[model samples]
Target: MLSQPFNPLPLDELTAVFARIKDLLLTQDKVDRALEVLVQAVGDAIPGSAGAGISLFDAHGRGSSIAATALVVEQADAAQHDLGQGPCLAAWTAGTTVLIHDAATDARWPLWSEAVASLPVRSLVSTPLAAAGGPIGTLKVYASLPAAYTSATGQLLEKFAVPAATLLAHIQGPGTPRHLSGPLKGALAGRDTTNRACGMLMERDGLTAEQAFHELLRRARTSGAPLSRVCSDLVDGRA
Candidate 1:
């Protein structure tokens, strides 16, 4: 007979877990380190998660493993990049979450599904990292058992996604010569919005970085708006 599904964590314990994650994000100064911590937190917080990872897209939209709780997670991400389609990529492009109950039988991404069949992963959930400009990447949890993630697990992960996005945006933004303190960090976060907006345009329209900036400039000029405002609109999809 098959074993029972994993039980969800207690509400109070879940809250405490998130509190610790918040502290982790606040204390981390580097993006890479922050992502490493974030993935570890996911593995710790979610029930039945064998591993967790962050898959980031470069300026050119090439996906790669940024961080992972284990080597299995990294290899899983690499398999998706190799196949050129997977739940994580779908989540990033659609700006929503994607769940696979069992990769061995999932037909949505046939190539990716077949490729990962030999791995320990059976079920997975990929949630988009919604930054100020748009979705920059995905946070994914891998499970060695089928039907591993439940509604409660998904909800918990969703709650974590918000601050995860902000922390990631701050890390991807331009860095100061010295460690930022006080209001400078907030100001830099705002600037990163524009930078991310430009990146989105470049990825979407196949424009060079300079061309992307000019496009933003052209839009702002024609619409009689500030560059930052135009970028914010683009980032938030008002443009």
Candidate 2:
């Protein structure tokens, strides 16, 4: 099933999810720190949130450069990636928003919810980072209270994700993201192989870059496998 959908929050009603980037303009090395600031700002603005997090998904749907406001929040996000199921990944794949109003009773992701039950994340709302290419990641908020997030909260998150995705795309260009922790380094290492596979598809099928990417996304989702693996198979002529 697709996730819940909503209109963007009005400009005047928007909050500080994208805090001032005064420090961001200074250096590229601070990109991760700036993302942390954004994540913290969103959590702070929420009334009953335990924390907030932003995750950029790689080919495997795992989070990279994940920034969370609290340790439990980080643990909960890690559980989602480790288990390969959760609101964030669901939202990203479906290109919609997911709200686990109460994780205790939410059966949509039984394994993910059960895995993080020991943590302080009783509720969660995550919105997709819908970019021009497709869903590249997600931004999520966690709360210790059941039903902590409402439609209004979901709308606010959608607003936050708009610019968050844009900022992430810009910083991921060549020569940027020199230090995005370590996950990004791994993604970068696989960039060449992915590009080669994409190029092969593009030339062989007359597909544009975006179309080639969508085809790869289709294959990855179909095989229930990582994008990296899908690309490798294609480059190795196994698919």
CA lDDT, every model vs. true structure: 0.70, 0.73
Estimated TM-score for each candidate: 0.65, 0.71
For candidate 1, the lDDT comes to 0.70
RMSD of each: 9.1, 7.2
- lDDT of each residue in 1-239, candidate 1, tens digit only: 11655555566765665566557555654545556667887888777788998876533334677678988898889988776578887776556788888888888778888788889989898888776656677888999988887666666777667777676555534442223222223333344655678689989999855457557766876888866788888999988
Deviation in Å, model 1, residue 32 alpha carbon: 3.6
Please give the TM-score that candidate 2 achieves against the real structure: 0.71
Candidate 2: list runs displaced more than 4 Å. Answer: 1-19, 26-29, 173-175, 178-239
Clashes of 2: 0
